[model samples]
Target: MRWWRQLSVVLALLCGCATSPGGKPPPEGNGPPPPVPDTLPWTPCGRTAIPLGPAPEESDRGVPEMVDGERALFFVAEAGATGQGVWASRGTRGPGSCLVRVLSPGPTGLGPSEATRVGNRVFFAAEDPEHGRELWVSDGSAGGTRRVKDLWPGKTGSEPQSLLEYNGLLYFAASDPEHGRELWRSDGTDEGTVLVQDLDPGPEGTSPDRMTRGGDGALYFLAHFQGLSTVLMRSDGGPGAVELARVPSEGGILESLTTAGRRLFFVMGHLHDPEMHLMATEGGAPTLVSMFAQVGGMAALGGQLYFSATTGKAGTDAELWRSDGTEKGTQRVKDLRAGEAGSAPGGLTVMGNRLFFAADDGTHGRELWVSDGTESGTHLVMDLEPGAGSASPAELMVAQGNLFFSAEVTGRGREPWVSNGTAEGTVPLDELAPGALSSDPRRFVRAGEDVFFTAADGTGTRKLWALPLRPQGQCGASASWQALRRDVVTSAR
Candidate 1:
């Protein structure tokens, strides 16, 4: 598939409407606000909803990232039309201001997506008639939106992916005619943009994947040498990248790379024989931490790593496990289910000093659970669905000191909910879908004073929605909303 088409598929999976695949939530919980002037679109709780294009031509499915403190950058695309490209909000809430303004509008659009903010600028990959899909940067304005470097120069792009901000620089994997697909970093300038290293050292580059930053400010990634081996390498952006470990040809797959403190953790080998390995970010050989039949939801908290797994070589039940980068320290936090059945805890997110995830005890089907690195401290936060029914909380994220996620209940199928690590403090926001249906809110991103997300409403059309960070004030009567509406009326006269 073409690069842009591949990206569109990934975006659809990431920002799925209705239900997620396999009837389960993704491993991570991953939004904005506004009131309205008379000319602007509006919603409840000082919120704003903007629909892009007409009907079938929906707004691009992805979370918008903040460029500065006020403006947010997003993309709009139609299946087979033009006049869509990079867009941004007017950067002010209370006024007769247009909610959004186009940064780059064209017949084919810019194909701008996968945005990452470095300092005050957002960097992304955009395609145009001239340059296929190269790196572009924006300061949330049309004048500021421009290409950083033509790496590949002509119509064929460098095809940059895995954009990450490391040590104040934007790092990504791109394919140039000379470098194949190697590691490159940019300081957001043509002169500053340069190749960091050549891993494979030929026309067929290493093609690094699973790029992760260690706690010690080093870049760690997996470089597949095609017919040879998959090398685990790290670079400090100096001379070259250091290979830490390797897996020979089809032995197994290395995946789930993460870090905690100065230790870099990853799982090597394939399913049913996965081995947890840890290497010191400073320098050392890879150490075997533990073994598991099935594992996922690996997260770091308080200098320790936590995940879900089924111990030994064969098991179907997966339970919560934590490791201090050692075999003895790597053990299950609790056997939540008591018998052969496992709690299968996943989406392990850190809020305050606790870890929150979704797990199933025998009593309650699958509900919200929390832990503090201990068996006793690990328990259900609330039975959101009450009885045997599972609330199936997905997308657990911490924004502005609270936990935000999506959960399904009796009256509400699946909707956005927030929590303070307690049952009473946990509650749902305004019903976006209403009735027994769900908007299936996902990809919550906080920008300025609001959180933005894409969700379907009663009309079942997915659009960008913004909600205040606090969401405490009454609907439609917030001070900001009233002021914004008044400004629109005054400006009309």
Candidate 2:
């Protein structure tokens, strides 16, 4: 069976679109000011919709990452004639931008995933009918592009994942008949790219995930063992990889691991008894940080850790909390949902001196909120959804000091939104699909003044798009498009 997945074209996805900023309801007699006249760096490249397979009905999912020293955005784009292959763009939002440089050509459709940059090269998991799926490397050119190794042999792919560069080696997980699915490393060579260890030993695989860095030499990750147990483990790209701790996972899972100030924090337990803990390594016993109802999204800001957790007590509610990695310093920032039902703040992100997230303050449904690590200062940015529902802003990210995310409007599905942490400043960046059609933007990558993300057309074909995040004057409606292209090309380049 082929491992590649195509978006279901016939499936109608009720998603959101991204409109321009400051698109709120104005005073009665007052009309909307003329649309901001200036260029957005958003360029549409490749086939907006794939031709060979089912297109994504909701989102195209263009995950733009820097290549060639951050000079351009490289991502997987599907074109009808070119099939699915790697593409590079200098932040061009125009159509067929994938033609700028077709990094990997697959007439039978190439599928790429787990892309990561190691120094000057981009390593990823790519699939061709002949090779199945294996490790490939590219230096943004045809001459430099080549296959690293075919670990699984043929017909069966090693299915490389958790690709990360640590201690001067590209470490990932691969599955062959011998090792099952264990740890593997590559120095961009066939012999150098051998099995790091068979942690699980035999057929039953111990799938290592995350591939996070712990300290000077090794990297920390999570791997599963016999009892379906999730364990905290570390590897130095060799047989020396050791299991740090075995989580008593009732549901056979360790929620998530996030790094903050030299410590790794995670949660454990089943639905009714989740606890958060902090660890310096996979070494000693982990220190219990909190015994909250549950800890979901978390982010580190200004040496303090912030996350959304529910207080499962009387009048229990979910709210934002912060800590100096101590129980004493840990407390709720604000009662967003108030009473028993939690506001359930998630998607914590940092911009400037504050952290922005999405939450439902009893009144305006689930909307955008920002905090300065204090309760009084934590407030809603605007009523994006307006009533008793959620605009549900997600994927909170920062680029050039501005916060960007995707959220739903009343009639719009989920669309891209940008904010400067003010009521008037928060608005949908563009109506990509417009009306009820959702563009469903994802994978925001910032380059200079522009923020790049992937979006699907109304037909659900994913492609690359960019938006100039910094404020600019109106070049007027007539000149805005041309001026934006020129300025963005200059600034981004």
lDDT value for model 1? 0.65
Local accuracy by lDDT, each model: 0.65, 0.61
Task: Please write out the lDDT profile of model 1 over residues 1-493, one tens digit for every residue.
Answer: 1322333222223233333211123211221234434343222232233322221123254443323233332343333234435544211232111112233432245455667767666788777677777898865455667889999878877888878888778988898887689889998999999988887777798777677888777788888886688888888864478888887746444455788878888877633334534333445667877766666778998999998877555566788888888888888888898766788887889987899999999798899999999989988898888788898999787865667788988886788876667776566766788879999876666543445565787778665555554333424344344433343323211
Top-scoring candidate (lDDT): 1
TM-score of model number 2:
0.76
Residue 197: error of model 1 in Å?
Answer: 1.3
**TM-score (C-alpha, index-matched) for candidate 1:** 0.79
Q: Which stretches of candidate 2 lie over 4 Å from their true place?
A: 1-69, 93-96, 99-110, 202-204, 215-218, 270-283, 313-316, 387-389, 411-413, 457-462, 469-493
Q: In candidate 2, how many Å is residue 131 off?
A: 3.0
Sliding window of 10 residues with minimal summed lDDT for model 1: 90-99
For residue 172, model 2's alpha carbon misses the true position, in angstroms, by 0.7
